[model samples]
Target: MSLGNTLSKYFNNRAETSEKHWDKDLQTHYYKTTKDKGLAKLEEIISGSSEYKINSVSTDHGEISFHVVKGKKAFVIGTVIMVRPYQTAIDFTVTTESALPFDFGYSSKLIKKLYERINKDLPLLDKQN
Candidate 1:
């Protein structure tokens, strides 16, 4: 199965509602979060795959980068952004040519908690919306 499909299945198995199915926005967020939370894993995945090249730099909370592979042909998987604001959360992203997979089944409050853990401050809009 494709990477996207595999992740969709994984999230679906973990979801409790139809509304929680993976979507574009969540996919974007997934890409952003994985890169932020798991760089070494990302690098490991890439390195273990076909020939690849990675370019990265440090950011506020962590690091971000783009991985490219040139083999039978040219292919750009996507970018990664990883963040570890504190001991609380590990945010990351994993973008690809296709949409990444993600779910939004947690309660708004739970999601707020997650945001707060990573961002260090909860936005008022999270409660308003």
Candidate 2:
């Protein structure tokens, strides 16, 4: 094969591989950023608010106290599991670990679609560039 043709073929293969790597990296970064933003937004909404009161907060793990202190610091003081049955055999379980009250921000489909949209080289199976 001519040198020009060989070089062209080599460059094309490298570009395809590099493009795949970039797409994967971008997706991972997007997820990380989205998760962080969602958590931050949840914190912003709940913390330093009267809605999440200390006395009224009851969970299956335990009761918690929301302490608002020193400018913008808010801390939750309580157990993770609270059971309040009111003398009944039925148990009200408040396990914060399993309970995610915050938004996850991006759906998997959305993220995938986003990755496709921003990626300069996609549909690698039909790659011509």
Candidate 3:
């Protein structure tokens, strides 16, 4: 991480995962599972955690909105897309609520942490070997 990116990340209140993010760890992840199964596993992970509270879930839209109740408060939106049968992609958008303009990369770290947990419950499909 360059000083510029580090500074920008710290000074920002949100973090998201997409195919185009410069950070490889921030890239959207694909899993080997059906859309319904993916969403079910994700709901299990989030709802089972005391640190999180699910605000709403739209399985039809493949979207889940939740709030972080542990440590600093934040709002998060998780998306699950079915690119093909048994191939699903997942992404996250997190916005931390803080008195300061930034949460010192809290949002970014949260995405990574959530990804780790999700990967454990689901088979991650890496784009590259």
Candidate 4:
């Protein structure tokens, strides 16, 4: 591996669990569902993923927050906000518990995977609506 890659891995392995890199590593997604339904679907998608484990959930103030553990090294904080009657916004921040200052792009990849799953699952929800 390149020097940068090796260094990233080393740092990531040593990174602190309590530190969150949200300032530079955050993703947002928009969905066409009500706030309540969007929160429910978000919970379902995260819970259904074998790679993620739900840590906590809160629904209040017109938004939902989810704390999830992704795999063994990463923690993900997801928020669902009601933007309009039929529009909702989902935001995710992923942080790695390692010594490294970087996660080798794991955070973005995790967000993408989550987005894909939610997108794919929406059709099923639509069928039931």
Candidate 5:
């Protein structure tokens, strides 16, 4: 193998392996919305983004998974869990696909981008309720 490939393998071996090297990129966001509303908002956000394509959705289980192929490649899986009547939690895992074992923080950036998008619209969603 080439020097770069050898180094990548060595580093990947040392990295966390949960969900196939995506452990560090897994993140959760809490929102003040109902489970149904949270799920709906997630669906709307993913569907509206041309960068993402829906892979599957399980409203019954409060999960929405999608893949984005643009400047940076990633597969995003999210879950909405209700804590109370109007309190909900959203969890996201962003996995970057690359020949190199390290993503150079691309996965984390993806999660932050999603959070920013959702957070920006949260107030409007709350007002409508």
Candidate 6:
């Protein structure tokens, strides 16, 4: 990672996963599952954790929003979209709640941690870089 990218992440309180993200961990991930199945897996993973409190789930919109209330407070949104029959894409948006200006990359680390857990439940086809 370049200094610019690293510093940006540290200086920001939010991080989002996208196909063209510079950080590999922040890149969009694809799973070998249907949209509903993918969403269910994510729901299970997040809801199963004591670190998160689910705010809402919308299967129609393919999105799940939640709050991290155990440790550092943050809002998280997971988006599950099935691009093809067996190819689904999941992305995350995390915003850390802190008294300071930034969470020192906490939001990014949270996304990475969530991805790690989700990878165990769903088959990771590839990372969409």
The lDDT leader among the candidates is 6
lDDT of 5: 0.70
lDDT score, residue 107, model 2? 22
Clashes of each: 18, 8, 0, 9, 0, 0
lDDT of each: 0.34, 0.29, 0.92, 0.59, 0.70, 0.93
Evaluation by lDDT, superior candidate among 3 and 5: 3
What residue runs in model 6 are displaced by over 4 Å at the alpha carbon? 127-129
For model 1, residues 1-129, the per-residue Cα lDDT tens digits are 477755554453122112133432232222223333444444554455455555654544344344434422222222333323321222333332323333322222222332344343221112101
Over 19-69, each residue of candidate 2 has an lDDT whose tens digit, in order, gives 233334212221112222323332343354554444444443333344433
15 Cα displacement, candidate 4 (Å): 14
Residue 5, model 3: Cα distance from true site in angstroms: 2.4
Q: Name every residue pair that clashes in candidate 3.
A: none
User: What TM-score, computed on C-alpha atoms, does each candidate reach?
Assistant: 0.28, 0.18, 0.94, 0.66, 0.74, 0.96
Q: Which ten residues in a row have the lowest lDDT in candidate 6?
A: 120-129
Spell out the clash pairs found in candidate 6.
none
lDDT, candidate 6, residue 93?
96
Candidate number with the higher lDDT (1 or 3) = 3
Worst 10 residues of 3 by lDDT: 120-129
- Tens-digit per-residue lDDT, 27-103, candidate 5: 35567888899899999999998999999999999999898877867778888888777777777766777777777
Error (Å) of candidate 2 at residue 32 is: 12
Q: Model 2's lDDT to the true fold? A: 0.29
Taking the tens digit of each residue's C-alpha lDDT, what string does model 6 give over 1-129? 899999999999999999989999999999999999999989998889889999999999999999999989999999999998899999999999888889999999999999999988889995543
